[model samples]
Target: MHYFSQSFNYDHSWARVVIGMWHKYPNPHCSHVVTVDVVDRTVDPRTGIIRTERILGCKQRAPIWIVKLFGGSEDAFVREISFVDPSTQTTTISSVNLSLSQFATCNEMIRYSPAPGGRTAFHQTAEIETRMNMWRSAADKLENWLALRFEQNAQLGKVGFTDVLRQLWEDAKDKPAHVSA
Candidate 1:
């Protein structure tokens, strides 16, 4: 198993960050994500917390050898579950690939919380497990390559998320505020 962790700060409130995360799939930086569908969404009556499940279809670029091995295609489906606690200003998300489990599974978790300056501090952790039925030496090489690729992808995701946050801020700024009764 390969593990990865990263943290970054967004110059927006936790609420906006959460909103951005929901709308992040269609952005230019994430063109690989072709479709997003909400499988479930509900609010807990007792705790007032919201929970959601979503599925994403992604088309990813693969190495030449992998493309050849997979017959020239690298499409994957991912499922995500998230919990939102507005009272605590926190949201946590966990995601994993739904397909190709035998070859590999990438499990990811992300947490968002309010920061000192009205920003949001985001923390992410991931584990990539190789489950391929291959020779030991080849499996080791594949795992190492996947680890390096995941690191690069994580950085790109941060930049994409930042862009999403900026768009959310602008959208919120243009909205009219509601007055309490």
Candidate 2:
């Protein structure tokens, strides 16, 4: 919710803060946190020539947060910047996954999950639009948050972010990590 850091010197080397959330551990690469387009994110089905996408790291329109839902899991992981409430001067240091998967059941989970509200029974009702509105509300807020970060980063130069954090290992490490809040 609130994050800040003092180690940055202003001479940022990386251009963008592109992140890749994975379902595996013991990261083979030396960097658990890859540079934004510091590398590529393509997996060729034939040659396996991984290529990094430009503007992959920190970008003006990209989502600072991403939500991933693996097929076999019921947990949600949120990847987002921990910024000091609305000041926008400095920034939250690391990419954190605020594990919000402790709700008792799937239905209950949906009730509390950070998904955009949408019609649950799409076929049999007119509330579908309303449900979608809820879902859209979350996305809209997330987009706004990301845009603010992009603007902040643009002012300082490129540095995926001001602070890099290690918050994913805490609660939802084993479950599907959802970064969008």
Candidate 3:
């Protein structure tokens, strides 16, 4: 198993940052994230909290060795679930790779919260583990590759979301008072 974690601040308010999260895709920085579909969603009226489940489709070329060894393709899918609590000014997202799950799994969690100076704090962590009992060497290689890919994607996600937020709020003279998750 391999672990990764990172934290940073976005130059946007918590609400605006959270709202921009929904529009981070189709970005040049993270072109691998090609499609996003909301599979489920719910809103708690009493608490004013929102929960959403989505499936993300990604297309990226894998290493030739990995493709040959694992018989994998360029297409992959991820299942993501997110919760937004307006009352607390917090948003949390968790995702797991749906493809190649029998061999390995990549679990990622991200959080956005209010920070000082009206910025939003972004924190992310991930765990990559191989489930295969045998072929220890192959499993290790797979885990390492997945970890590297995840780190790259994470960086791109940060840049992509930052751009989205800037485009959505920075240029606008009037920002929306409230944005639903």
Q: Pick the candidate with the highest TM-score.
A: 3
List the candidate 1 regions with Cα displacement exceeding 4 Å: 68-72, 171-181
What are the RMSDs of all candidates, in order?
3.4, 20.0, 2.1
RMSD of 2: 20.0
Error of 3 at 133 (Å): 1.1
What is the C-alpha local distance difference test score of each model? 0.80, 0.26, 0.90
* Comparing 1 and 2 on TM-score, the stronger one: 1
Candidate 1 positional error at 157, Å: 1.5
Best by lDDT: 3
Off by over 4 Å in 2: 1-134, 158-181
Candidate 1 on 23-134: residue-level lDDT in tens? 7878787777889999999999999899999999888877887655434366878899999998898899999878656677789999999999878999999998888577
Q: For model 2, how does the per-residue alpha-carbon lDDT over 1-181 read when each residue is reduced to its tens digit? A: 2122222232221111112222212233222223332222445565533333222221122322343411222233333222221222222222322232221111100000111231011010000111132366554554444344423533342222223313332343454434443
- Model 3: per-residue Cα lDDT over 20-127, one tens digit each: 888888999999999999999999989999999999999999999998888879999999999999999989999999999989999999999999998999999999
- Model 1 lDDT, residue 102, Cα: 66
1 or 3: which has the higher TM-score?
3
